[model samples]
Target: MTVGYVMLCHTALDRAAQVARFWAEAGCPVVIHVDARVSDKAFASFGRVLGDLANVSFSRRYRCEWGTWSLVAASLAASEQLIARHPEARHVYLASGSCLPLRPAQDLADYLAKRPDTDFIESVTTEEVGWTMGGLDIERFTLRFPFSWKRQRWIFDRYVDLQRRLKIRRRMPAGLVPHLGSQWWCLSRATLKAILEDPERPAIDRFFRRVWIPDESYFQTLVRQHSRKVESRSLTLFKFDYEGKPHIFYDDHLQLLRRSDCFVARKIWPNAERLYRSFLEPQEGVQIRAEPQPGKIDRLFSKAVERRQRGRPGLYMQSRFPRRDHENGKTSSQYSVFQGFAELFDDFPGWLTRATGVGRVHGHLFAPEGVEFAGGERLANGALTADASLRDYNPQAFLTNLIWNTRGERQCFQFGPRDHQGVDWFMATDPNAQISVISGAWSVPLFRSDLPFATVRAEAARLQRIETRYLEILRSMYVKARVRIWTMSDFIENPMEPLQAIVDEISPRAARRLTEPPQMVDLTGFGRFLQNLRNEGMKPTLMGDFPVNGDPRIAAPRGRRPYLVQ
Candidate 1:
């Protein structure tokens, strides 16, 4: 059986080398995605240790989002390219940037030879409603982010406090719901192809646009939908303490890794040296594949950031709260509706109002701007509106409408039904321009309405000008940083057809050589721009918010941006 190992990577070049070395010894073909933010010098520095093995290849460099589809998209793109490069690749396993092989590659090949048809991915029916990061939402399936927002330091503390004081009950956006699970996945080539060649790919794409972390779900949910037989549990090792962070592999956790019966466990810090050795130690009657011990570096690495809770007297305390757990697995529409406003108004109301020009913005929840009494509607602001649609909408009718709109034949982007209420549909176009206006990361609900189009377009144009001006101001910064790629905040999510048209219109001038020689962040029509640039014999670097895979690439570590120090 032909087996392929897909290594989805971001940082820790030394550890990546160790893992790659282990897999190389197993004779498994390996592909790695090096993040783009890593300096060329740094990548070259690590390349010596990583060495060139016949089985190992590096991905084109790209930056990755923390909890979005970028992660999944990057992986899928890498897998597609990997298969294209090595057609003999058979079983493709999605391993994290920080994963190591527990068994010989040949042993894994033998194991898969026994079940060619069965995909080892974790999958389940939407009916089961199991442990998803966001309950039943497409966001759970489409988005990718290297860092956990819930685990990150208090970037949104005021919102959390406001939520507690208001005792607010949020619901899923109007058309979107959430489904969450483990991000690590393994799959057969057939299943992987089905995902890439899905006839309803547009529908899936739309669905995940609103889903939280499409990276984790894109393959998982699709395999469950298309494949006949699937294992519901992710085969890799993933265990969490009460706080929901994966128990970092410290020396103390070595015994536990041996007994867990898992294929891999994330995320060892680069500092861990001893754990790598322990993984090589032999145990009585334990086959290499079934052995429980960790690699030598596993024990010596410091605790993963996931395990650390930077507590303060009043600022932060790690809690076993449902919200924290659900942040990874589930998010209610009630919560998201409030969260939409929270991310907007609570954190930086002035900046938002100035950008969107919404006067007296208290909390512009996307409650249906219509008069209605039934189906979870309430009279507020002298007009009757629903706080959310799906909350009490007719389920059968609602689901039918959602599915219908999401049909591939439709011209406009159509995400399916809401996993929650009052939010956008399960899949929606990204609010790229509005996101730029608000100076926030890509998120749904920011562009949940058709009404925002004119405003968004206007703001997008203005922002382009502003961005151009900002680029001019930062010319020195760009030069000093040696940045070859520039990411734009000007793109908006919605009706991608027009966006593609825009990309075709302006992609050329945007990529024209800057005075300093760095590539400008191509907006809208980047897909064609990339082609056009290549045709012009100008190999301009791409700085997409999402990941792309081929050859080899490197990304900067999260929180370790060159501009900032921890």
Candidate 2:
């Protein structure tokens, strides 16, 4: 049995596109249903970033208001789109754009192949004990509001309360039982086809169109009434916190996620994009995030300083990477939202090479966070441009710090161009790294910004001519610092271009292995971290499946694991 994907998305197009691309790369056919309320320009932006992929398609726009029937409408539309094109698909996987698949597609499909007739969805009958938290409210199935009742605090809710006080209950249609569960599920094709084709399909659909949060009940009720072969369990994992919404997945949840047996998890946000990216990459061994312990806190710090003092430089690790604003002492965010590329710095040659300059080093920023951050409805391939800096950086000024580190004792060095008319990279090796201006041309500006600020149109395109020099300077600095395999640490969602460009420019030997991409092994080799998914009969992604990491340069150091410094 083959598998297909149906994603329900509202915002964060880049995050959505990244998830879509992950599945597309996994050899699954994907259908997306973006909310109709999204502006055409925003939807178009998603399309533009995704470009022309062979296996991906979008559903017709439908008004998808929260806690309303329109969400189910959008989901139904996506399932239709997937089934219409890929009838051979046995199961239609339903999830949100923010949802991530924990198991490999092949494994999940193989598991489903073993049981072809059963529909997998979470369901609790209205009469079931603890069906709706405190108990199922009668008004949910009886509500007849034309618009989303959640939007107006007074109108529908007050009226519904009045009706309840008067004991006016709308009776459910005979033979139709009310069932509720998560809005997302992986339905069997037979179940989907039956639900879509049932003579009562239209009747049921129209019946729930006025129900509040119909998405949670519509499919649940239909599958229960229609299918005898049904699994009362959802394939998607969720932790509905106190707010009744799935907790947002973040870096800390890596272990929990990897260990989950569920095929999918929901409520992932952009800050966690790097975690998903790492999951997709699959190279750096099992991901295990540990909270800092109180006992070893001061010891770790003193030991690090002592080691550095003794010529045995201790590694400096901080998982909570913040935006550049934090470095300048101006950030209010507890942690930086972008850490995908930063993690690369801790891997293989990244740590092995850059460790050559250990204490107090300042790297340049090409694509920064916040200003040219992974923000907006940026889908994919929305390369960072110079003009984007105008929103944050001075219009007349050029060159802002993207990244820097502590590589030397009492000495801080920064690598960036003096001006961008042309591009070159430089670093101060002494404590005088904070100099106001260069005294001479040995530190000469490679490219002097000459064109009047008025002539600038597309900042990135306008400056594309000299980006080569910018890259060259970066390569030269890496060479000068003797940092091996200088991995680009700026990009998040779109790392291929910058990664390939840097590799092709600096080290051609390592660039070839990236050609074929990563491959997945069968599910029998699944990782042991799946508790949530395993409990549900869902398997983790195929074992031995890893991100592209065969290149000797990117590979973990030959002998032993890098010392832990975090």
Q: Highest TM-score among the candidates is held by which one?
A: 2
Candidate 2 structure quality by residue, lDDT tens digits, 1-566: 48898988888878888888877777788998888888999999998877767788998888777777778888888888888898778888898878876655666777788778888888887666253542334567875656545678578666667766787666666688888877778788988988888886777777787777788788888898777688877777665543354557788777667655556777776778566775655453443233212233334434644443332212212432222212222111111111122323323223212323222222222334322222222221223343444523542122222221222222222222223222122221111122221111111111123544233222322233343344454345343322212222112123355444533433344443345211211222112222323354443221112233232123334587789888
- Model 1: residue 119 alpha-carbon error in angstroms: 1.1
- The global Cα lDDT (0 to 1) of model 2 is 0.53
Q: What's the lDDT for residue 358 in model 2?
A: 29
lDDT of each: 0.47, 0.53
Candidate 1's residue-wise lDDT over 504-536, tens digit each?
222333432222211212233333433443464
